[model samples]
Target chain A: MKLVISIAGDNLQSPFDARFGRAAAFCLVDSDTGAWTAHANPALEAAGGAGVQAAQFVAGLGARAVVSGAYGPKAYASLSAAGIAMHLAPGNAPRTAADVLAQFQAGALNQAQAATQDGRH
Target chain B: MRIVVASGKGGTGKTTVATSLALVGGESVRCLDCDVEAPNAALFLHPVLDRRQEVGIPLPRVDTALCTHCGKCAEVCQYHAIAVLGQTTLVFPELCHGCGSCTRLCPEAAITEHLHVTGVLEGGLTADGLEFARGLLQVGEPMAVPVIRELKRWPPLRRPALEIWDAPPGASCPVVETLRGADFALLVTEPTPFGLHDLKQVVGIARALEIPAGVVVNRDGIGDQGVDAYCADQGLPILLRIPMERRIAEGLARGRSLLETAPDYRPAFQALLAAIQDRVNTEYAP
Candidate 1:
């Protein structure tokens, strides 16, 4: 099944967008195989408003669960309203994609109840 | 005529140049600060806004009572905005773009849209008679484009007055929204490698949008000379250069404009304004 996963963590806020605001990291994962693709929040992308498209892209990639460091109430509410499963993965290290998936498969990692604070943690 | 001062990189003096030019242009011009997320232009212009209005976005609201959890809304949502876990229906408003696709696609018609305030737009006049508009996005609010869009919903200019815009940094949505109607864009930059890199990124966007643009190098003495070389290679004119000055930094820290503190630089701004006017006149002449 297709999914749109909101993501957060250290790697998401890397110095990539120093000139612009940092984008939340999101992942699109497959339900059957647990494969995933990563994306920067399109909303925080150049010229803004890329969030919708990014979310759609994640959904297109067949993400079932949105794994992120945190989700503010508004973001949480909006994503929840949209039918996406919101999961908070707070303080997760920037590991290889496999490790993240491993955590997901083992049920050791679940969506955080909330998105982390907006700036540098 | 409208000129948008923008930089793909932040802290490159976009606001400094914009406010200085507005001050030098004197009473006939207006300024709009479209950097809704972090609007610092007001610090320099010191505009006294007489009016303020809330900016809003539409989000889909589901009527749980009227509907069976059919999963149709979930199916229609490209962003996974709606999920039916058993009988419970969940909505995540931040991820929702208010596209109204789910409401229309829902077979049960259980979905409706509601307006959610994202920010506020403020308008007023600076001491020198320049009309000013600014967008202040609500803190922690993820949506900033709506507020920036609201700031641009002004009555069309009835006369030939310069509308200089202070655009937000980054080549993102807010910058695009602010630059929508600009006759020309004054791209500000520093001389750093990172600055040159982002300048290229934004330059591509400007080219794609078909907007005629020029460059203004701030802190002219710092960084490498690549930014200048790149501008020359692109055949884009370097309109003006502001030499690195300690006083300018001090003035900015104290909430004052560079032009206000250094009246001697008025002539430089005037010359810059004249060059821009020439560009606009040549391009838009009847």
Candidate 2:
């Protein structure tokens, strides 16, 4: 299974970003192989529907699960519809993508039931 | 001639300037209050706004029975107002820009459009015989450009001596809609840092849109001389200056226009109109 974590920098050690759609970069890790790759988020430049665009991009990447601080309604709808699960990053700011991914692997992270916040236009 | 009284910063007396200019510009003048979000020119002008109409956008509604889960509707929506997920398609009316791209491109023809009312356009004649119109956007509505667009188009003007467009506060989409195709932009601003900062932004917008703009410095004595210096540097002529006064604010609280608070300034506003007309003719005669 592949898991994606929203991050600020290119590496797994990059700081975790609270923003799902406007995150600077997304770090994807293959749980079985432990191989990781970072994909820069293109939705940051989207004038509107940034959440929808980001969700579509992540679904296209074939990630089974996504880790982020929060998800907007639109993003949550798209991801859940594509059968991709969402896990909320534990704790507050200053956390790293790798830190959150470790918690995910340890079964310590909480899975989201629905959208965490209001959607922006 | 159309003169849009705009301000990058709010509460800089845009409505004050626009209303007064309309009063002085004679019965041949019309006032279009384009500040849809918080339109208040009616409070001062006391226009008998008997003529009213609903303003709305064409929002798409998807019929799930016919929807093939093709996701084409989601892909075509630029505003992300629609989403096709698995067997379901959702429509976010607030996010919809009413561009009709999704409705037109739905391959199965499952999408239909309906008018979603967002605002109201009110107009009639002011007590002073000036044709007055304003757009009032519904509370919490994100889009104001559509209402502003309708205000300019409805009950069309008859090439009045001047059309005073009272624009909203900011250099955003609605402001652009208000300034579009105007003969002049009468930019109102206070003499403060915030005023100067936003003024610079709107000036760029005006110049980019190729609209000839001038400044009306309301509350002229309150802030530093930055506005004067910047206007001079930009070669944007200072057409009028309304000094900071307590009586003006007092009068405004009672919903009095600048011309009503101090009718002596009537000549000043008249001169302002003449100056704008002369500049428009001399500089942009077609």
Best by lDDT: 2
Residue-by-residue lDDT tens digits, candidate 1, B22-86:
88876777788888888988888878877888878788888988779887886777655555554
When summed lDDT is taken over every stretch of 10 residues in candidate 1 chain B, the lowest stretch is B153-162
lDDT agreement with native, every candidate: 0.72, 0.88
Number of the top DockQ candidate: 2
Measured with C-alpha atoms, the lDDT of residue B263 in candidate 2 is 97
In model 1, where do residues sit more than 4 Å from their true spots?
A: A1-121, B154-160
Error of 2 at B59 (Å): 1.8
Q: State TM-scores per candidate.
A: 0.72, 0.89
Q: How close is candidate 2 to the true structure, as a TM-score?
A: 0.89
Segments in model 2 whose C-alpha atoms lie over 4 Å from true places: A10-15, A28-37, A91-99, B157-159, B284-286
